[model samples]
Target: MSPTCELADLVLPSTHWTERDYLADEVCSEWVFGQQKAVEPLYERKSDVWFWRTFGHRLSPEWWPWESDEELFDWQLEQTHAGVTWDELKEKWIHHVPMMPSRDFEENGFGTPTGRAELYSVIELVSGSKPFPEATEPKESVYATPDVAKAYPLTGVTGRRYPIYYHSAFRGIPHLREIVPEPQVVFHTSLAEELGIERDEWVWIESPTGRITMRARPSDGIDPRVCVIPHGWWQACPALGLPGYPDGSSNANTLTSDRAYNDEFLTPGLRSTLCRIVKKKEGE
Candidate 1:
């Protein structure tokens, strides 16, 4: 039997030879046994296996046969030998996978665990996590602590915009520089006035963890309780090997704490934290 079939037999012992299993087997085998010189073999194989396993059942009946595992393996080997990288192969596989079935929701009942639309989930009750269907403030809101509030008085939100030219990456592109051109730190107008900071003036946004400087854009649209910092700024200082961008300063990932992330879901709480901003002093 093929390596795919062998793996399938090992993992899914009870299931019959379905087309889903066959396709999954082939994809996994290729990822595992494909060329390693141009790319990592095991990494490629594991990723491919996951992709096929996740979406393989969505394939239509007409495309079910999968043309045999041997043929699939041979084709992958040929592609690998031709210098096609694993990333490229994975992309090809994703592009070629059959599209999901299109049908009105009324015809097909909801696919929830209870077989009905769930307003609240029993998942939390069973899993011993938060017992709610929607987001709620953590049992211990970090902002509630007096020390945390004093240290980081403003709410710091990250990932508030697109990757290209959002935070500090704008310095890398000339066109982006000509257009947006500068790092923008958004704050509530009331907060800016309270801090005695003017719009378009330099402000130092500091949290208990770290600090960075950006031009303030005080606006009424933002919540007064929160301060917004768009992600993807690369610190630009001549001394730091990046010149033209004196303030190429960011990658919110660096300042964010893994411990502050959600407990049950493990989602990063980048948007739900407090921070404080002040006017940057001259000569420093």
Candidate 2:
């Protein structure tokens, strides 16, 4: 559906934000403002408003009677009953929502069934779930099988973030790669020594689900029982890496199992899986 995926029949290139105008609210519910364009649209880039308006006209012309973004903004302002007007905001570049004083809890009462916070939730009980919140073991973690643990003893904690690269993004930049050049799996030095692995050496982190090769970094910060491998590395992408690290980087999820998941949420196990790290073998 996206550019790399190449699943779409039509791919209309749009303009970046620098070439277009935008109106948005602040992080808080306090202010709404507009940002002006700095330059003309480059290449085939188009403003976001243009697409929304175009799509709206196609879906239903009556619902989108406005001819331009300005007209739409005016109509939205007309619908608001506040004392302020769009003209004032156009000059000010911001519209602030007036703050209200805190309400009296006892006199006003809460918008709850008992007019107060309930220690016990009746909704959860009615749904036939746990009445109280309690920590439970990860169903797919440690306690699965005694035999399995004998082979894959260590615990894995994946998805650690790096400051230089974001989740699969910013990797293509040369400057960022120069900062943190390789994807590494951190382990306690003691564990590495016991496993016959050395620092900076290639190692294979293996689980019943899958295995991946990455560089080993010795660190006291890492728990001996737990191994840390970062997420979002792609050997297939244009991301640069060290000489030993190839064009195809091992993504943590490739070695993660999706077979078992929470019945209620239907989520895969990205963390808390049984695994072991060892020196990379000849074939691997």
Candidate 3:
């Protein structure tokens, strides 16, 4: 579902959470509760339970316990607080269970070596994870060797766009797009003058892995050496129209690389990749 979907022969629309009999083991603040459905579904969509149970019965007839979702739901509710039942949830829509602070291990203190908070964790030491939060240089940095900087001069950083859009999602949402119309690449005012890049000019940000285009906005708040791009763009918007999406609206991932990463986890270096900014020519 990223870069391209050359292998997908057909696609199906999915039911939104609001459209079905919703359920979740939600943990918020100090209590846990089971969520219930809100409204009836409108489209040609079916509940996820139907799909899961159908697949389960097909995959393992011996171990699959239930003939219906109601049977499975009843089985799950039986594990809740002894006094509560699914009937209560159907009527009240939620049942809250207080976490057992009543446990008598001296007011349920943290089960640590000191019987209190331990700044240095013995648990991580045993698990072989990093015991302390340590700062390390990015895999790619502006302070890197002179030759490396010359080749890819600017640092690329990706950040959240807005509350409405989660990554590349909801750009097609008209009201959300009205709040923040388009993606923009911000730069320091001095850097903009140095590069002869005018305000609102479209610029291509090229990393070692790939390149994407974004509009330029000169601001003193941003660092000249770093190019901050918003996250989650795809080539499927109707604004592009063409099956061949040559423009950078889908250029979101092109500004990042996986060459360097966190030592403990192989997470991509989204904020550490090096890139060069270029003003786009006419019609590009």
Candidate 4:
């Protein structure tokens, strides 16, 4: 054990090592193996709590006693006899959780130095960015300026699917691929026709910043101005040598912007952008 520990210590570089070496070693274990064990438990626990809180009333009568015909004690005995453990039975049947009423106020009641919800936030004042009570404009209007809007006409939205094998990652799988086989650029039928792009054909989507190639999928469900591309596509497999797809293809991140995002929260707006699409040439 001591020898193995000594060997591991030797392999793990000191804090003074450069970022690239640190990242290379970190990725081998942290991304490849450690990620699942680290993340799955937090996700599972949150999901379980959400399930219990959201639907606990439906499964047991005691959860809604004012509406229930039976008493709480009767419900407990009934649940316990059915082979549920005491803790599980109590969580399902005996807890009396209160529900809060939803309210919307012009001012949410917290005051700053001005003693009111500042129409302009303190940060805006401090940073001299833009004043608060900012005008509400249609999302596409940001690009409506004559010069900027012409180059990037369509609203490009991304990242709206499950994490594992979303977008184009699982496109090579038989059963899953049958459902959705490739990175899809979703646009309205009229827009697709205007661009002379056909459904399921490979098209190059471009922003002023960057571009990536994906299959077009025209749809009426999305707003006419909005175009969607789901996220999470791994670089293509080199060993398999698949046609029309090369190594390092299909990551939506390639076409996304790196601008400072919206002010409500520090979260990056991966879902919103401006782009245009064109069909790929025959070869190369």
**lDDT of each prediction vs. the true structure?**
0.57, 0.72, 0.67, 0.54
Which regions in candidate 3 have their CA more than 4 angstroms from the true location?
1-10, 28-39, 74-83, 101-133, 144-146, 235-249
RMSD, every candidate, angstroms: 13.5, 4.7, 4.6, 15.7
The whole-model C-alpha lDDT of candidate 2 against the native structure comes to 0.72
Worst 10 residues of 1 by lDDT: 16-25
Taking all chains together, each candidate's TM-score versus the true structure is 0.52, 0.73, 0.74, 0.50
Q: Point to the candidate with the largest TM-score.
A: 3
Q: Which residue pairs in candidate 1 have backbone atoms (N, alpha carbon, C) closer than 3 angstroms, thus clashing?
A: 31-45, 154-275, 168-233, 233-250, 234-248, 235-248, 236-248
Candidate 4 local lDDT, 1-284, one digit each (tens) = 12234457444222221111111113322121111112323222333222343456677736643232123323443433443333343345332223334343444645465656677777667765575666543334344444555877777778668444644445455555445555677889988888787889888888766788788899989888777876665433333443334433555666665552555454554666777777688893
Runs in model 4 deviating more than 4 A are 1-145, 162-174, 221-224, 235-248, 263-268
**Could you give candidate 3's per-residue lDDT for residues 93-200 as a string of tens digits?**
666665554455578777897677677877766777676767777766767445667878877777746788886667665566666666778778887888789988
* Model 2 Cα shift for residue 87 (angstroms): 8.0
Candidate 1 overall lDDT versus native: 0.57
Total backbone collisions for each predicted model? 7, 6, 1, 0
- TM-score order, best first, reads 3, 2, 1, 4
Q: Could you give candidate 2's per-residue lDDT for residues 55-151 as a string of tens digits?
A: 9988999998878877776666555433455556667777776655657766978665567766675655666766566676665566766677788
lDDT of 2 at 109: 82
TM-score quality measure for candidate 1:
0.52
